[model samples]
Target: MAETFERLPEAAETGGWLVRDEEAVAAQRGVVWELIKQVGQNLTQGVSLTSVTLPITISEPRSYLEMVADGWCYAPIYLKQAAVEADPVERMKNVITFAIAGLSNTCVVKKPFNPIVGETMEGLFADGTQIFCEQVSHHPPVTNWQVLGPGEMFHFYGSGELCASFRANSVKGHQEGIHCIDFALDGGTIIYGLPEVWVRGVMWGDRIIEYDGLMTFHDPKNKIIAEVKINPEVGGWFSWKKKLPTDYIGGDIFKYTSDPSKDRSSVSKISGSWMGCVLFDDKRYWSIKDDCPKFELIPADDPLPSDSRYREDVSYLKAGDMEPATEWKAKLEDLQRAEAKIRKNYCQEKGINYVPV
Candidate 1:
């Protein structure tokens, strides 16, 4: 049986523990506001804010690569179940449920450290799931990652290029990447796309993370697709009419026909809040309130030189050494910039265009 725990109060949900300290919140907000104000003076609304330097006051004590790897905490359970499910649509149900569960693991109020190029992370989850990630590029920042479920039950791999644009009170994130999973069952490959994320209340209102838009899960071998709509908060005033769950997601699994105009038959319905419970065809599949498992990075005996665990900024932050953490963060960013310049110059001298491997 899975254990259950009460959710944190609204303050934790909005600001996380980092912002609950009034003085710290005030100091952090002041810094964030200054950055926003500077951007307002010089940049357009949708311009990339990658160059905006943020203090360590708002950082989570982990690299973005590690954060992404930890998102698959529930994969061991779901992928194992998916491998044994006879029906293709049911297998997809398990897969999509795993996908939604990943979202909950990643929806944090604080930002994680952007991975430095050539940085790598390898860890094993408590459930024997092994994961690896590498920061393959710096410009446009991309990371390549792969996960292997326990006993080779499943394989999940992808490259992620997360981009964000800052607004007066929010940041909109575009998750550009295709993710794929291969399970033990025959023809059990699922390819999927991610939804956009909106981190609201950065400057004024209560800070919250919301996933918007649709994620499509495609099983080409079975000619089936599942379209999930996540937290539709559009249409300003009219949004109130829906009155849905805070993290509501609704989707339908259907078999695709060769004729584009032909109507397709629905195989099953998926309804639930990604942050909490998920139901497939009215049957509960997963629930965070009941079984919100977490991934722990097992200590490696022989760590790589480029491992995120060796990063001084992240280590200091985890140890609650704020001043040193901030200093190391700045030093690392400067080092990354210098290394990028060297790489650019070398590519120019070689008459070759720089490309992420």
Candidate 2:
């Protein structure tokens, strides 16, 4: 008797829509498959079984479409899995377990286990048996996966709750300085009758190298399933030092000038005639017009110069010095009399009274 088998919809006609561009869809599928294969190979080579768990859960079925002249159809299905572990030694194992589980689940839903692809059909096995399986039928299709951001370069993806929280914090520009990782699993077909599984993990070291616009994920049905608009909030750490001039001055000297010729020599000179008259009058010409000698000669009998009265005036102008008696006595008396007369006049004019305190 011949063995029975179920036939899957061709990769180009898995979905109802007719694929117009078959070559493009095939190319995309090929890229996706290559990435999935690389990831699987890395997991198998890097992970050890003693310290890690297996058969981790994955979320979201990967799907793509083949465009036809009239419509489109779903293609072969792709799947993804992710996991996290603090210990470096067990992290690879965790990732591998999830990847294997994802592959096995895809096969169980789409086709029977083919021993030719290294899939086994053992009813029951004793403990400590290590089974290795390979599948030639597994082909992953690729799609564009873009990262959007204005925050730290890294991210992580896990369970729905955790992803929601991380996304919220990242949008707010409050995500801590940790790496982010994102896995995009996409293919050309949708498997029927399988419950959508929940996927969650700790992703590290993900960054946005270039962002054209918003981030989006589409299923094979051409429906927009997930979208995150790009509104990059600003955040970072920075420092600066105070800048000061190398030299500083305390006060302006121009305000204290007393003589224009001597004081203003430091400034540029301005020369011009005012009202149509020349300003440069020679000393010789002025003396001749005034009928006076050009220079005066002092007489020998001149009295010794005495400034006793002006001495007190000079002292008062000096801001903080005692006035001489002979110079300041008369001035003080006159000031007192003036004050008395002003007070009497003010009292009489106002017709008001006040006792001296």
Q: What value of lDDT does candidate 1 attain over all alpha carbons?
A: 0.74
TM-score of each: 0.86, 0.14
In candidate 2 the C-alpha lDDT for residue 230 amounts to 21
Residue range with the least summed lDDT across 10 consecutive positions in model 2:
66-75
Number of the top TM-score candidate:
1
| Cα TM-score of candidate 1 | 0.86
TM accuracy, model 2: 0.14
Q: lDDT (CA) for every model shown?
A: 0.74, 0.20
lDDT of 2 by residue, 202-224 (tens): 12121111111222222222221
Which candidate number would show the highest lDDT if scored against the true structure?
1
